[model samples]
Target: MTRYEPAVDLNAITALDVHVHVESDDHGHFALDEELLDASAAYFKGSENRTPSVQDLARRYRDAGMAAVVFTVDATTATGHPAISSEEIAQAAAEHADVLIPFGSVDPHQGAAAVQRARHLVQEYGVRGFKFHPSLQAFSPDDPAFQPLWAALEELGVPALFHTGQNGIGAGLPGGRGIKLRYSNPLLLDDVAADFPGLTVILAHPSVPWQAEAISMATHKANVYIDLSGWRPKYFPPELVRAAGGLLRRKVLFGSDYPLIAPERWLADFDDLGIDTAHRPGILKQNAAHVLGLR
Candidate 1:
């Protein structure tokens, strides 16, 4: 099969939403196991079908006059649930080149194969980035076993995003269904960021209980960025709002972990943030454009 690739026309879009998911494929293949899916849905109390085809996502974003970076995480070994096809997402994005950007995810626990997949997704499929969920993927961010995976992506010049806080996947479950929150401790990534300075790292979400650490790390590391997603701005931690709206202004990018947290709801709440309207374009789009190497 031909590998996935997307040719985005940056000029055609108004905002680049950097964190969106293609939760399920058309064939009823889900990105996570059934139990986790159910548990996650319950945590969010979401009644909608979160999983939509990449084509559907393209239409959703296009209608909003926006663009999205879509990817499905591969936790095959960890979750023992086959992941949605990265190649398929990429190919679909290519078809919707007007609005979608494809990211590839690799189960770092897969070691060598993960490195190979990272290469294939970039060199062979044209993925611009990779996503990892240290908690769900069952790997410590600083583990040496996955060094090769980070090395490959770094060498390829693609950014890496890690889900870094209380995860929806296992929330409110009996024992949180064995998903360890400790694995996602944002500080663990401090070592990875230090070791792979060339790798552009994104510490996704609010990183609760460790929000201070997340903010400190992003402030200390030039290559580290934080996407404002997974939580509404009105509910934002006071410190995060201060940093994004003032202190770490350029270091923050807007991302609506769409479906779970719709863009409309996110933007509506974000509208109240005392951020200067003049900087809206930058936070909502230009910052990501700069991070993603677009204009």
Candidate 2:
């Protein structure tokens, strides 16, 4: 029952991967059901090491000389599958605190219970932040019903990382397994950001099909940020690359969407994007450090 505390030496880590998933527990329970897991593997194509446990992830990131923020999605109501325990994940991460930062997830649909659990994850277990998948969770970020959860996080003074734009979780399944892409639109989070200025909101992934909107939010809102994850750098939208080099440089962070997209592969492709030399360090590590309060 030890509370987690980061032991990472910022100087020792070359990067902080902010979007890694701990899809399984030490007990062999998976975060997502077989159908969604298989679908995501197919969608990512290069998802070679899917379903790694927290310990496995710690070794992988540590070997790479990096730190990772690991979390699992809790979409119990939407997927009808039990989620891997965020509490357990946080406790496990405490053992690998040097290279692992744990972020908790609660089914937003759980209402008051969700808020209570979020508080416990932060005040008790010491989770650094919270992760949400709007599409997979089947809830809109700006929906007033979930405002209490956001308000709780705001009060707790931790960031909220939302999966925006396209999701690979249920990709290619019938109706994408009822996971609505519309829920993940970056614009939906603009309201949440506006409403909760105290809460830092990170829009995960490139927000494809709405890259312009994502850019607009990050540029216009001080509370909003974008994480470069889920897609290879070579395939990044031109506008996003341009913004990352200039206006959004400080507001953008690096992430690998690990297990699905390895950090090694993501970094190799990032080198080819021709991003400004000045912005590289911030994107690779500094920005993430600031966002996670590691600085």
Candidate 3:
């Protein structure tokens, strides 16, 4: 199997979408169970194909003059459902290296095995970073049991993008399908940012209900960042817009949360936010490039 290496020409791409999901494998296997999948589709009012393979993502993003960081969350142990293989995703991404950058996921509940797999994905498969969903994975980011995994990632020299705020995965289900929303609170990640100062921590989404906490963390921590994804820019909280245009411009990155929310729709709404022209390039591409070490 060929190892993944990015061949993307930075100048050719208009933006870098930092959060995109590959929900299905080339085979028929899906990343989430049918119930959760249907719930999410309904939650987003999505009529489009919800599950897109890595190749489909590459072509779509390339057609839009953009590049994307693609990944699947391994919530296998937490959900009792198998995940689409990160290894396979990375190998497939290598074939479309010009437009696809792969990020690896490991079920945090697996303890030592998770750390080893993370190392293998980065060293052998060449994943640029990692993705985590604290709620779906049923693990607290600041839990003492997971310190080793955080330490390993810090040593690996890659960022960890954690899904914070609202999640569509188990929305509207009984007890939200046993997924605890409290685990995703951005405040929980503040301890992680403090403990692992060397590790770059990306707080995904605007941290709804806790926007102040998210904004504060990214503002206070040098290694912390926020990605504007999942929600359309037109609906962004006033403070978030203010921060993105001012103090947090260099710390905010672009992400579309594709399939559920298209990049085209996200960008179209972003244009109306009236952020300063000077900060637009950094939010759209430059900041993400710096985080991904593409500079």
Candidate 4:
């Protein structure tokens, strides 16, 4: 088994996409159930193949002259569906190290086993970070029971990216398939960030319905950051665009939430946002380089 190592030269890539999803494995396993997956596809109204493997991701990003942080959400306990193997994803990413960076996901409901798997993913597979979808995973991030997981990631010295705001998963389904939206509130993560100051906590996507709370946390906490994904740039809230240009420039990252939102489409919309050119570089790549220790 190959331990992951990043071979990509930061200078060679035009931008870094920190939020691409590896929705399927080579063996035809999907990260989410068919019903939820179909609902999300409809919500995003994206026509591209939604379930791309790691190799497909590498080719797409490489062709785009970009590097992508690829991961799958493991909500096995919550969804009762087997997750795509993160280890395999990381191993595959090793083959295309120049374009793909892997992140691992563990179901928070797994308790101590989850903590152990998280360490294994980092040490054995060389994952750069961990991904959690609080809404889909059906767990509250600030729960004391999961403190060990947060502490483990802090000691591991890798970032924990939590999906904040509205989730496309389970959208349009009756009762949203019992997925509790409250768990994804960015405020829930304020506790995690505060308790684990050493942990780099990434708030993925624009935390809609609580946009101000998300911006405030990133501004208030040095370790907190925001990845702009899930929504197209043209639809970004005015305050988010404002903060991304000014106070939060260094803490914001570029992410496409690919398959749902393509990087090409995201970049095209971002170009028209009129953010200051000086801050563009940092948001597009430099800040991610620092966060990922790629520099």
Name the lDDT of candidate 2. Answer: 0.93
lDDT score of residue 262 within candidate 4: 87
Per-residue lDDT tens digits for candidate 3, residues 187-240, read 999999999999999999989989999999999999999999999899899999
Candidate 1 vs 4: which has more lDDT = 4
List runs of model 4 lying over 4 Å from the truth. Answer: none
The per-prediction tally of clashing pairs is 0, 0, 0, 0
* TM-score, per-candidate, Cα-based: 0.96, 0.99, 0.99, 0.99
> What would the C-alpha RMSD of candidate 1 be, to one decimal place?
1.5
- Flag regions of model 3 displaced more than 4 Å: none
RMSD of each: 1.5, 0.8, 0.8, 0.7
lDDT of 2 at 167: 87
List residue ranges in candidate 2 displaced over 4 A.
Answer: none
lDDT of 4 by residue, 48-107 (tens): 778999999998989989999999999888888999999999999999999999999999
